[model samples]
Target chain A: MEENEMRRVDLVVIGGSAGSFTVLLEILPKIRTDIDFAIVVVLHRKNNFTTSIADVFDQKCALPVLECEDKDRIEKGKIYFAPADYHLLIEKDSCFSLDYSEKVNFSRPAIDITFKNAADVYQSKLVGILLSGANADGAEGLAYIKQKSGTTIVQDPESAEIATMPNEALKLCKPDFIANVGEIADLINQF
Target chain B: MRIYTLVDDDDLETLLNDVANKYGYDFTEYSKASMKRRVNRLCTLDKFASFAELRYRVLNNDSYFARFVEEVTVNVTEMFRDQHFYKTLRDEIIPQLGVHSHIKIWLAGCSTGEEAYSLSILLHEANLAHKAIIYATDINPRVLETARNGIYPIHLIRGYSQNYINSGGITDFSDYYTANYDYARFVDKLREHMIFATHNLVSDSSFNEFQLILCRNVLIYFDKNLQDKVFNLFDASLENLGYLALGSKETIKFSHLERRYQQIGKEKIWRKMK
Candidate 1:
């Protein structure tokens, strides 16, 4: 794809598992708050009733961070994290829908579920990034994003804390970029 | 790449319309994303070669349509879910309701009766079981049947026990049920004050006035229009000062009834002021 032919990206969905938390901690503070698109992060985690991961992210992140609520309208320049124990889907009307349906890939808030749903809504104007993890959850989702003509990125497996996730994604689809955390952050900053 | 085509939005609309006309079960206003996911799952589970084949079977076969309704509705629930919410009820709400001579609690969308049984245990522990009547209702008759049976898988008992203890349970959790070969059948005494029935929040009217109404995690499946309708139903069904509880992620903040109800504590419960 030529640089000039790039479509304006409206949504960026990032999916990660096992070792993704530290990677996000490093990448989020570096992201500029003035970006036009919304960012949704879906991470595999246990349901903790006492505290929220979004509240933690909000403290370190430049942009406003929120735990995605049912029927929340998607907004630009904001960051949202999928709530635990639910599958978060992007609606065609630009709202978030939470489902308590059965877990996919042995996990709720499955990366592939969100990625596929977002791809259906955002189509070519989306960006999907799959980061460090120990499972195969995000591979199909990253591939679906590529199939939808959206940009796809995978953390270089060698640079990942756990190579299984990125390596699985690599087997499924040829992402537009494969980079380390620093390079991934740099590419997002460019957007 | 195992890319399976889901039911298209238009196809979903067509099928929902047909179901509504044929069976009076309307799902047209449900969140499309989840609905599509469930329908796609049903197709695969039932071994349908195409969406057309699935549609034909659902429209023509009565038993198949029954299975469709059972599979489509979300039934993922457990005992003492979000233990803190139950803790709030155990510590704060139930104590307040205990002052009343009779307590009427409506557990809307009570799938398989786990929550109903949990509440019954709370009431029994509080010594209010004799005066408390729990009306547990769900849209699906099949699940209502399960709720009436009050039997659940034994494997889940451990988790339920933990949640019960966390929720300030006073008695032994094992005292409530007897372990059978594979399932734990709750004591018949727990069913004495409980009533299980089919009640559709979408198409049915409010059946009774209640001091407390719990429709947790159920509204997340609805769109804004349907949500407002159900909220109004809950509002009408609730007595003045009656409490309404929603799922953790759901709220009445932006709804028309927001001003009339006040959030009680940090939990998802709301009390009607007037």
Candidate 2:
């Protein structure tokens, strides 16, 4: 709930499902307040509306928080959350898309779709971070990022709030770094 | 010599993959069965004694892969292939389309430009050609260049003419083109409002939204998973209430997002639901 300063992330993709909020809280305070890039957080949700995620994320992070919009431009130093009921896609030109037209992995805002598209456009510049979740949605997407020459990080399964998602990702593509909450944020600030 | 005999599915896949990587023409992600049949046929027709022999010949012959791709996924479309769909477009959609000064239509997977030229001809008949923009796209560059040429075997003209008559031709079909020995040259004006480019409907996202989208015949070859992926892309690239037409055998039913569309009927027309 404290104010530090504005920081930019060139592009950060965070994936989680079962217990991601705790992970977010641990990492938010450690990111440098001076960086300038966009951060996209894809957290799984039921078909119901996502009313409180912005409010919750806003309290723990220094950056302004809001759900992404279709055709919305990604600007630096803003924390954009994937709105429920849509899979967020990054265009070739680095704009965002809210595609509710289909569901992948039985979840809208499916992690794989966003990660793959983001990797395609950003390539080696992409940083895909997978956190704790109950499902396998982020596995293929993380693999896509590594295959496309992007950097990857995942929450260490031993210390995760829920280890299923990060563990699934390890089976698919071994990430460049696996760390606990304290170290995860420490590394993100390095970027 | 009887080469290509040990060419099982895996062998066929590897050979095709090698061909694609060496020649820069990708068939790796295409329908497995279709690719299999084509590789088998190409080897048989070219007369190789074994898979090794076939791979050797293919590695040395980049042109063979070029023609192989052309033969496997070639549009094989003639003018007005579906008369009833054309009739529905004219009688139903056009009347309700209102008088827009310019119309933009995307013909996704528009192999060799048959459907693009057909639509152009229809717009010309309706006095809408000068205001129409038809962006026809295919993944194969060779096919795109062929489409740019706008020439077809004169023999195919007879069938196209028949399809034209079946679809309610108002004027003689020959009015659209001139017979030049073995090939027919379509009127240059038909190509004026048209742009043919290489686009992969499967791997590429929809770049621009259009008032109408015609992607027929091609989806039948894709698996259900890929089909659903592409249908979603089409949904994004169509304007609100924009028309989406699929092939006769194709439907939005059972897809992950079928409820977003309103089907026109057995006519193969669909509209984005607001």
Best by TM-score: 1
Inter-residue clash pairs, candidate 1: none
Model 1 Cα lDDT, one tens digit per residue, B146-220: 999999999999999999998888889999999998899999999999988899999999889999999988998
Runs in model 1 deviating more than 4 A are: none
The first chain of model 2 has a TM-score of: 0.90
Residues A1-191 of candidate 2: C-alpha lDDT, one tens digit per residue: 01242222368888888888777877765577765567889988764342558777787777787776444568877788887655676655565644432357887778987787677677787889999888899888898888877888889999887788898899988788888888878767777
Encode model 1's per-residue lDDT on A136-159: one tens digit a residue. Answer: 998998898999889999999999
lDDT of 2: 0.75
Query: Candidates' DockQ values?
Result: 0.75, 0.01
Name the top DockQ candidate. Answer: 1
